[model samples]
Target: MISYFNDYANLCFEKFGDRVKYWITFNNPWTHAKVWHSYNKTWRNKQQGMVGISLTSAWGEPVDLTSQKDIEAAERYVQFYLGWFANPIYSGDYPEVMKNYVGRKSAQQGLGMSRLPTFSVQEKSYIKGTSDFLGLSHFTTRYIIQKNYSALKGPSYHTDRDLVELVDPKWPDPGSKWLYSVPWGFRRLLNFIKTQYGNPLIYVTENGVSEKLQCIQLCDEWRIEYLKGYINEMLKDPLTTHMEMVTEIVVPTVFTLCILISAILLMFLLRKHN
Candidate 1:
């Protein structure tokens, strides 16, 4: 299955490398093999193109900062989400927590071998240090804590990480169950990326707020504030914030214009009344 994807990407590279300067290969060991070969061996030196994987994470704040279990669970949240993909590309294997927990669970289930696959030295070497940059997508934040569940509930990716996620009631939730506007989490996530994978070059690939599909939300007050707060946090460090340039500048400008106009109209009415 992996080889098939590799061949497909290679075909695209063979035909399109001259025109396409950047690429993002999908996940999996085979995915990296194809992506690295396509860029490093086949096209990068020739075309100077780049290849990376797009990854998404929600920042996990420990339920109790001082509690070791909560802190470990918070790290597990990252390991399960971003590290599930990033670790292999950057560090050459699955996270230690992932291996340990999965292996222990598999044993309890009376499996002959661990359900989690071990990487061969060759696979690890080939996969390690393969990515050119880290492409990240992050949203909101969650308070995390440790939980132990029965493997009888079934072996699944979600269950492998024994953790529970909670959110603060005070966070400004813009009606999406999954998204809460927690801007400060952005800076923490960026810093984590810097420290975790040896500070690879990072490009933020996606971020969004969910809203009911409306024909027109011209004022767009909710999203504007969300972006404003989030972008400000990102700027606190020298990291990135995402969106199209038009929306990035224009939305805020429009918002400021509306506030100014409303304020002026109010003053005009007050003076007339007086």
Candidate 2:
């Protein structure tokens, strides 16, 4: 498997060269690091970040903003769920805060290091800001609670954040397991990226709803609504307007008007002759 992946990476570089500036080698390895690695050791390594892992974040909300525990847990959840992958990808480092919470037993057994991969000094420079545009795939986030360390399952990498996650009972469900109606998280995440990652170019890669068996085909009203809400938030970002080009919209309108006036004048002259 490692050989095949190495060969594939070589093939991509050989064929694409520097032309393919934006390359997504891997995405959402956390889900695999959790479920697959739990069952099979071989599968875990096979599925690990051979290229890189996308820290696909389900940006959760705090149940009680006023409560210190809730706020800390919410931040922890963000760090564990999002920071776990992002920290390594950008800074080539793991969330040390996560290591402390993941507990001792699991840490010794390799579950802690199992999920997070360390980069070589060379790999660190290669992976940092490798993306020409950061494409984010987000849906909904869980509201987190600080549960007892014993109450948590698996390893330190999993529970180091000291947060247990659940869907907001009050938030309207979009029918998927980890998804709920939370557009604010999307905005918050964008702002976080801009602030943390020096405002790189961003593209909303996957933002949608699970309609379930309620409908056969994809009408996607929920997706449309989600985009509208989040896009409005993105526009509010101070950097968003920098890319806003007046030339593209205005040039076409001006050209069309000039053509229409010329055509109208030509027609009027022909009509007078008739």
Candidate 3:
């Protein structure tokens, strides 16, 4: 780690200098640490590994909009899931409130020094504005409530927050068993990024739902519906379409049936004309 840092830092100043404006040292270290490392000890220690801190932004929607308890719980769930990693990258530290609420035993066992890693003075300075653009990978948001810790079992980070997540049965489950439609969470996440990081350039890196099965047809009405809602919400904020060309770009997909129809038509016309 030390050698890599020294090498990169030296290389940056010597060769790249002003040419290299952004540096993303790590991406998705949460899944890397929790899932990969937790699963196997040897795999965790392997060197020459790319340790990105890219994490799933588990946005939560309040089941009851008017209820203050539900509102607070929704906010708490956001802090526990999304804010846990995003806060550190932009702000240079973990959300202290989260650490306190997670309880002592959690600190000792699964997340010893916090699942969110700490940064040194030098590291923070390097990382703070390191991103030329913020990247967000999202799927669906879970609904959460402040349930007592007794309900949860296992030494997992989910239990640490003392909050339980629930998915609305109404949400159409296409692929993954866990994901549910919580459209508002996308808007909230976008707003949070704009407000927190001085409204830095953002790239919605991964923002679509999956059907998992290959047998699913290309006429994906559900995916179309998901994209339309989320994109419309995103468009509501003008700042999202700032001094950047990214938002303007849209690549249309060629449906499989359309391709097949075109091929068949071409063949039929060629034979008839010939």
- All predictions: root-mean-square deviation over Cα? 9.6, 9.9, 12.9
Q: Rate the local accuracy (lDDT) of all candidates.
A: 0.81, 0.61, 0.61
> In model 3, where do residues sit more than 4 Å from their true spots?
5-25, 30-55, 103-127, 150-155, 212-217, 238-274
Residue 39, candidate 3: C-alpha displacement in angstroms: 33
Per-residue lDDT tens digits of candidate 3, residues 1-274? 5455545544543465335433344455431122222212322233322223445576776777887777777777777766776666667656766766654535556554555455678765544433435567777777767765642355566666666678878777767676665677788877866776677666666788876456655767777888888888778734444434353432122355678889999999999999
> Candidate 1: lDDT over CA atoms?
0.81
Q: Which scores better on TM-score, 1 or 2?
A: 1
Among these predictions, the greatest lDDT belongs to 1
When summed lDDT is taken over every stretch of 10 residues in candidate 3, the lowest stretch is 31-40
Deviation from native of the Cα of residue 258 in model 3, angstroms:
45
| Candidate 2 lDDT by residue in tens digits, 1-274 | 5455545655665465445434455566432222112212322233332222345677766788888888888877777776776765556555666655554435655553544455578765644543434557887867777766652355554544667787767776666766777878778787777776677666666777766346677777766776677677657635344335345555677899999999999999999999
* Model 1 stretches astray by more than 4 angstroms: 27-30, 212-217, 238-274
Q: Higher-TM-score candidate among 1 and 3?
A: 1
Sum up the clashes in candidate 1: 0
TM-score of 2: 0.64
RMSD of 1: 9.6
